[model samples]
Target: MEYSKKTRSSPRTLDLNHIENTLSIILSQVEEPLPTITEIAEQLKINRRVLSRHFPVLCHKIVTKRRHYMRMSHLAAIEQCCQEIKEAIVSLQQSGEYPSESRVCELISNPGYFRYQQVRLLYKQELQSTLSSL
Candidate 1:
């Protein structure tokens, strides 16, 4: 399973929420058949290995009869992330940094956001666990 050096050089600027939301929806549809990683990566225009390397939670999110697929892990990791996001929203509201609820909403809705990797960094235990699997 040796990886090429190019896989190591990609910039970590992917939209985390887009990944999160996409995975969330994929997992939410329990009864429907889902696309393979190859399909997903192709649709996203990202390298399959790169996407897999960047987000190992996809492993936890898959499930299959033959053990090749993944299923979302029913754990506190996602819930914890949502809590952090909520708290950050509250802080932003109190600071009044961005005027208008719609503006704040727009900021939050934009996937190209700052501090996302920092937030990911904050959940080191969860991230580390997934990275170890990778």
Candidate 2:
């Protein structure tokens, strides 16, 4: 009779807490310029597939929510910039100086200054309509 040896393979164990902590660190580090998932995974010394497996919902939700929050923050910043432009125009008017496009562009220093101008116009229109209805 001949005896055969059977080999068993051990299953890979995942540390969920470690994964969550790594994810938290990645999310917190994302600021003005956001890093791609691949970049983040590479930074963590892991592959995207492994990351997605451990944090499926988090993989999508955290990035989506962070992007949404960043957009909201950008909008708020534009609104604040528009308000400052309005104040600057008022100040220029008081000083008997005409507020020109070149002057505004130079003062604002934002390439999206025109968009903020539109926001300011819309805000004024809304305020006027509300006041008229009162």
Candidate 3:
């Protein structure tokens, strides 16, 4: 009987912020133009052969083309949206309620960040509108 070979687990987890900061540093080091794969991995201390495996988790692609490097932009958009949500939540604190649940439901059903194409759109509009009417 032949003994089966065991494979070792590779590097599994990396801090998201660390990876983004490394990418920023790598991008900055180049003069306006983007750096090559080797340069990015070198700055980030990530192995070029396996770096692609880690990126999809931390950075969702905003754009991609066959010849161009993939563009990831979801983080900024999500972060900005979250900040606006927090502000709306704070405003609601003074009042007893806000129409958040309904609006959120609508948003969930439709699957879009903007509600009626308004920036920082949130479900609590009904609550706010109700308060204004009183």
- 67-116 in candidate 1: lDDT tens per residue? 33222332244445545545545565467553233443354443233235
**Consecutive 10-residue window with the lowest summed lDDT within model 3:** 58-67
Give the Cα lDDT of each candidate.
Answer: 0.53, 0.67, 0.50
Clashes of each: 7, 0, 1
Better of 2 and 3 by lDDT: 2
109 Cα displacement, candidate 1 (Å): 51
In angstroms, give how far residue 28 of model 3 lies from its true place: 3.9
Lowest summed lDDT window (length 10), candidate 1: 65-74
Residues 1-134, candidate 2: write the lDDT tens digits: 97768667675676779878877766666554456567767877778888888788777866686678788888887877777666655565566666555555566656365655675574465445544654
- The per-prediction CA RMSD against the true structure, in angstroms, equals 21.2, 9.0, 13.5
In model 1, which regions exceed 4 Å deviation? Answer: 1-12, 63-134
Candidate 2, which ten residues in sequence have the lowest lDDT sum? 122-131
**TM per model?**
0.36, 0.59, 0.30
Q: After superposition, how far is residue 35 of candidate 1 from its true place, in Å?
A: 0.7
Measured by TM-score, the strongest candidate is 2
Candidate 3, residue 31: how far the Cα is off, in Å: 2.4
Evaluation by lDDT, superior candidate among 1 and 3:
1
The candidates, ranked best first by lDDT, are 2, 1, 3
